[model samples]
Target: MFAIERLNKIKELLLAQKRVDVYELSEKFSVTEVTIRRDLDKLEQKGFLVKTYGGAVLNDKLNSLPNASSGDTEQKFVEEKRMIGKIAAQMIEDGEAVFLSAGSTCLEIARNIKGKKITVLTNDLAIGLELKDAPGVKTIVIGGDLIPLSTMLVGGFALQMLKGIYVNKAFLGVKGAQLDSGYTVSHYEEAMILQEVARISSEIIIVADYSKFNVKGFARLGDLTMAKKVITNTQLPNEYKKYYFEQAVKLFTTFDFR
Candidate 1:
């Protein structure tokens, strides 16, 4: 129980959980909250995490993170996305048609769609591939030209195909979210596709991780009014929880699944 040993163990926990509360860490290590704060300060100085009011969130840049509209999705918030996806995938029921919009978080949902009797439609090439061979799951890739680096198909063909379906549920991944600005994205085409999906769906769900809460994007996708539910990680800021609640947007986090 040397300080060095405790610090290293805290780092390990932060790596796994992505965030750690000072109170929980204090109890876990049989140390005072003051001691845990000092440890967090040490870790923060080492560029491991960014200290919040009561805890530390892992510093993810390409590896500590946020470009607002979009960045390399695969590289950011790996564990957080996995947990968010797990919760979202559970909402999909048997004999339902669900739309999973493009993004790494949606790809995680596609991965967990196994053992379900459902039809999934998506413009995300990665998500389509992930569910390509899933048993009892029918996957339809919206046809169009692929967008560079993003691996998404969007445009006239994608829209034309979207016109024919009545989706029971639609899950979209956004670049950022803010109470004033709503969910936003970097590209107009992405916004168009998302809007069309939302229009044709019975229920709309926005899937994002904790980092997207305060961040703003270039294009607004509409206010929280459009999204009936938003799925994110437990690490989401409290201000956002209040915002979503006020907007009457149901928020589901990783804690629900755990």
Candidate 2:
């Protein structure tokens, strides 16, 4: 395999097992021990792992560990999330009716919708609060059982609120995006509500950071074709870029820090 592909495989192994033996990796990749050691040394310098006596361990201190909860997940991808939100927000035209799903990135989208006359239907309590002070924007909060840490509402009550209302666009945030099983969120209830949102919207725009790619969550939302566009940062892998492009799904990337 090529060096970049080998490096990615090593990362995937470290993510799944938390540690990797040099001998095992060398055998698995069919390369010499010297070459595997060199790869580990480079990954160590990039803060992806730590070299040990005979192997390497995933760098927990560098965010290589899995997140414990949605709250932790939201806080970990701050920069990419904010940029994704900014790009998604710019797609909105004045007076459009939009559905903003519940997540940190969706909250950022709500925060960035400045000086626009729009109607926002959202289950996220935090997003409602953020839009309360913005002029010419009508914020509708879908009511149900509140998921406190995520500041969102879900379940039958929220589903009832969405009935019969069609939207111009739906901006959704998901826990993961997969090539086969498709977009998913951590909670089944949230996934159900998101499905309803997708049903009523004429257009779907998924707002997610690059970290979410190739990951699968507990509940499947929809297939990849459900979304017309995806807003994310430039860190998306070339493989995914080619896949999305081939699928005719438009991708918008924001690489800017500001």
Top candidate, metric lDDT: 2
List of clashing residue pairs for candidate 2: none
lDDT of each: 0.81, 0.83
lDDT of 2: 0.83
lDDT by residue (186-215, candidate 1, tens digit) is 568889999999999999998988876766
* Cα lDDT, model 2, residue 215: 71
Evaluate model 1: give its TM-score.
0.70
Expressed as tens digits, the lDDT of each residue in 21-133 for candidate 2 is 77767756779999999999999999888898778877877443456222433444566678888888889999899999987789889989958999999998889999999
Give RMSD (Å) of candidate 2 vs. truth: 9.8
